[model samples]
Target: MSITLFRTLEMLRHVPREPRKITTSELRDRLAAANFDVTLRTIQRDLQKLSTVFPLISDERDHVFGWSWSRDAQVETLPGMDAATAITFAMAEEYLRDMLPSGVLELLAPHFDQARRVLDATDNGLNTWKRKVRVLPRSQPLIAPDVDPEIAQSVYDALLNDRRLKAVYRPRGREPREYDLSPQGLAFRDAVTYLVASHRDYDNVLMFALHRFLHADVTDEPARHLPGFDFDEWVQRGGFDADRHGEAIQLVAQFDMAVGDHLHETPIADDQHLARTDDDRLELIANVKDTHQLRWWLRGFGPDVEVIEPAEIRDWLIEGARQQISRYADASSGR
Candidate 1:
């Protein structure tokens, strides 16, 4: 394919599926707007080539055109692998990055290779492209830094198979303990990942952070799904307010106006609502799961922020500040 043809198809990728119809003149207008400088004839030839190789459906009489994908069409269309599968894997890689386990990537590597080969056969620049399209910085990972890959794989496999697991866990500041658990769900919270399960020892639902486990062993014991323990309800009750369960609580914090712009641009919450107070303070509302998590987040702002609501939360912040002040004074006194 010519560079012009490749560029045109790439542009079409951005167009929505429902509004798949585009007239020749509309296509030309779009190309011209994009500074492509291509003629109508070139666009027609490009569309024809795309239709033959891919799934570009058109109604000539109605002057309407759109793109759709079929399972068989996807399998047969790729110069080697279909566009859909290739795009899916590429997009997944872009989003998941280090969040995915190495074992999962190994399983996906072959499929990704097939897609790359197909793109290479097209002789498009995609084959030789080494552009840095996306960049994700290395920060402290959400999960524990030293979680054993083998143990992670075992838990993941158990989750996939709906199997029960027996494990020895050593909670922070606690002794090692063993339990037989029915794994109900898994979640990543406050930079930690946890397995929510029904514990035989407690006879209640409990969350065990994956990183805290000393050992995780899958058992042939029959999996038991808990009754009246709706995952969604349990999550919400735990103050997570998440869609399925453990819903996060919405928290609002007011900050001194000096750093309002900085806070607005670099939000501390995944979802934040910002407002300017009459007293020149910036109020930010965000969803958080636990008071401890919120306190830690607020501590990052030092004196610039103040907890605005949830009286208990505000008190906790005050107490944390007092503790820090005491520690500073004691350190100064060399005690």
Candidate 2:
């Protein structure tokens, strides 16, 4: 290859090697940050053409299409990155990228470059171990929602520096209003990002969507804090899944053989018990915290599980089914 073509290939190789799933916009921005000066159009074209030769694949799974490599293609390539640090960043970026500080990707450009080299190494080591790993949510994968970058950046900046933000928050189905909020943290749940913040005068916390901010301005004053702010504690007790824990309830259900077998492999709770029924179905009884997640879990096994006790939960499910039936009552049936 010509010297310039060789350089192009060398740079492009790092993308699949770091094993990042990045959009064309992200790739172009990263290339620009690294001084490549490649245009977005050219980069898109290059990815398209290179896919025919390399293991590269374009994933349109979410709203933002990302270009990544086919992990199963075991082509021996060079690894130019450290095995440990690269894996940490790779996992973080993949799982929590939506919730990270807005300028993180830009700041992490150089590290990603080095990581790509290490991950691409042919040596059978931890650097290449990501190829054998996969992390997926139990819920059916939904397309990712969009967040405005500028709004997210200002929020991150204020939080990182302990400053406050003057933001316009438009809660769902409500009028847009402005408020001075002290940024606390960010939460990612079911593919959406929630900005955890508190008003200047009170210690009570409120959540605002990153995309809901029509306007944001970083203020000069330092943020005031409550006595103790533990992100995990706040999340577990009071954040997004608002009713994460409450009155514990006894849950008993009968499951079909398939759902029952899967539950045996991964019990929902430690105290769960499985007893054989006369009809060959699996009967399960467990004490679980009343939470939205539990309901969602049971819904996934629709037609395979039935609530056997706790008339309240049974009534809840029946009412839900009736509501759904009412919704479809006016609609025609599928052939």
Candidate 3:
């Protein structure tokens, strides 16, 4: 067949596969939007022709006929879709949407159909579960970093195949720098995927943002095997925590009645103790890691909370508040 005729037949298959019903005009519009350049009459005629063998149907009772697959049609003819795999794809389509490469999702499109059919048949509203559940960040929400398809695929390929990679990594506004490394592990946290990898010449493990990879390629060399690498331990050691600064210290703070009321449900730590004072304030003490995240948390409570110790942290907060107050004062004076 000619390429044009082949593409026409391809477009014919897509018309009825939309998630919802479509009129011939709507189908033509979809084709146009997809850069198919087909006419509405052509779509109607193709639908009429394909209806003989396909499970295609049209609502003739309506003033304007709308087309879709037959309600009772089984998607079994499409591909391999066992009940288990179908449900798995249904869940993966949502949960792994941000985790996996887009190419993988496209490769699993047939299974998504299987998932859709199984979900629709079950009728227990499992298909709509995406709307019912939400995974929110503990901090203020922010837009997730955009990941490139080919770059992500290459990263996964290297990590999964236990191969080394040459990557051009750019940090913040810095210029891109090239390096050769072995990917140790992959982690997803707060809408960002990180690559825990080590330098080719050293034992140091550094994390790379998947989105920040300008280029990456799987190399022939095998990845360096680190015998005692543990992702959880690395995380607990604040490998991924940007706020980890200074040594761990005993964090002591005082909270007003309002802040104390809030902390009743969310104590600073498991071993934290709150003692009431004469002025109805509560003093809290906990042995915690001296991280900026803790400082930021206390500062967020504004006047309701006060940092008492270590003296260094309290001094840091005092300096920060002074800077903020001066900045505001300057802004008010039209600086």
Candidate 4:
């Protein structure tokens, strides 16, 4: 595609449908991010010229008005989506829609619609693929918390452009506080999304839950990065692990035959050993991380699994069982 056409197509994508709008300056900045490097006057002219051919409108009610696509515009994406691409987009739209930030999801709405159209037009077996697929949650489903779309948009923009972000964050069980964040990466864990970032000039990083952000805006200042920092390595090192103890531990446990049957095929760790015991139980030995998730998983197999080694874990389980029994007893006695 020609440079003008490419820039125009990208600009159109950035211009949200009414009643959402984008100012000329904002469009210029976004275009610059995509390496368009056009002047504000040039952006205004391009929008005015493109408006004649496309369903685009400029809101001139105010001194500094913005542009938007007409509410009913059926804009098709360039280099049309193929059947395979359509199916992939369809799957993502169905399965991962709720997990994405609202702002990001909104940006994908056009592609999702295009995917639906492409799939609908197809008369082949691929059209039925979406129906055949299934994604099941392992645990009981929890409703995803609401995240402010504007805040999410700002964070995304900042991260994409490697710019600093300013956000008003509300910590759990605490008052809201504003902070300057240098975003490193984003983590989508289960239902919640977290922004891994550093505060001000700090070298150490922290996680800010997207739902907990009251407000956010990106700044022009460049984001600071820790020297030789690797996001993947950080994840492997248990940066996001809750209630984490130092390193890996030798986990020795016993499980009832019925409960531990699946472990024979799907071991907990690479070095896991599972064998049938003389008493018809299953013995499990593995080296695993000591994390809150580990504890939760172990506790979930109540009465079906026993921690044979790791004195602290064993004692913790015993105390938890005792408390649970005591609570039931108290309830029975109307305490």
Q: Which of the numbered candidates is closest to the native, going by highest TM-score?
A: 4
In model 1, the worst 10-residue window by lDDT is: 69-78
Per-residue accuracy of model 3 over 1-335 as CA lDDT, tens digit each: 68567656556555443223567876776677767787777788877887897778877776877887664454554355655566667777776666554544544565677677776766565657646766543577544577765677678878988999999999878999998989988887656788999987688788898888898888879999877887677766667665563366788888887757766788778888888988889988888887666677877877787888999888888898899999999999995
What digit string (tens of lDDT, one per residue) describes model 2 on residues 137-188? 6566654456555576678778888888999888899999989999888776
Clash pairs, candidate 4, are none
lDDT of each: 0.64, 0.72, 0.74, 0.87
User: For each predicted model, how many residue pairs clash, with residues at least 3 apart or on different chains?
Assistant: 13, 8, 0, 0
For model 4, residues 137-206, the per-residue Cα lDDT tens digits are: 7676565687876777788879998999998999999999999999999999877889999999999889
What's the distance in Å from true for residue 123, model 1?
4.7
RMSD of each: 17.5, 12.4, 13.6, 2.7
lDDT of 1 by residue, 93-185 (tens): 655545654434443455666666565565555544434355554335453245655466567756767778888888789899987888888
Off by over 4 Å in 2: 1-81, 91-110, 121-128, 227-231, 241-245, 333-335
State the displacement of the C-alpha of residue 83, model 2, in Å, after optimal TM-score superposition: 2.4
Task: Write down the worst ten-residue block by lDDT for model 3.
Answer: 12-21
